[model samples]
Target: MEILLAIIVGVLYTAGVYMLLRRSIVKFIIGIIFMSNATNLLVFLSAGLVQGNPAFVNATTVDTSHLADPTPQALVLTAIVIGLGMVVFILALKYKYFEITGTDDLDQLKQTDEHS
Candidate 1:
């Protein structure tokens, strides 16, 4: 399962980079989303998967060695919230840019910059 997840993470990262290299603004946003998800998965994978091991311990619990780490989970959750905010901001910017420029192609942005 770990191997599969690692492969998936690699694929997602590759796809994200490929999308980022595209000229379309929409594709760039997709790339950002892909990368964010990949990062979350990578963090989760690094923490190691422990089946039947709870993160929280109770009075009846005698062994703490098999307990799962919660730090990565918290970090991933925080990252998800931040990534969501970033995506929303970027979407708003894309909308405004499209409204004014009437184009989503990044290459057009170069021409505008050159003129300025």
Candidate 2:
């Protein structure tokens, strides 16, 4: 299962990077989303896969060998929130840029870049 997930992560990363390299603003946004999802999946896999195990123990003397680690789960949750904020911020920027420039082409933006 881990191997399959790892392969999936690799594929997502590849696709994200490919999209990121495109000249379209929409593709870039999608790439960012894909990359964030890939990172979340990675964090999840790093937390290890346990079956039929409790996440937390109530007793002070309880054994923790079979319990799933909560840190990675928490980290992934936090990362997801942060990623959402980043995507929203980027989308806002893209919207404003489009409103001003009337184009979403990276090549056109580069012409402005050279002028500046």
Per-model clash counts, in order, read 0, 0
Top lDDT hit:
1
- In model 1, where do residues sit more than 4 Å from their true spots? 111-116
lDDT against the true structure, per candidate, is: 0.92, 0.90
Please give each candidate's TM-score: 0.92, 0.88
TM-score of 2: 0.88
| Candidate 2 local lDDT, 17-114, one digit each (tens) | 99999999989999999999999999989978776775867768478888878888899999999999999999999999999989988778766457
Model 1 scores a TM of: 0.92
Residue 44 accuracy (lDDT) in model 1: 86
Residue pairs in clash, model 1? none
Q: Residues 59-100, candidate 1: write the lDDT tens digits.
A: 998988888888888888998999999999999999999999
lDDT of model 2, residue 113: 57
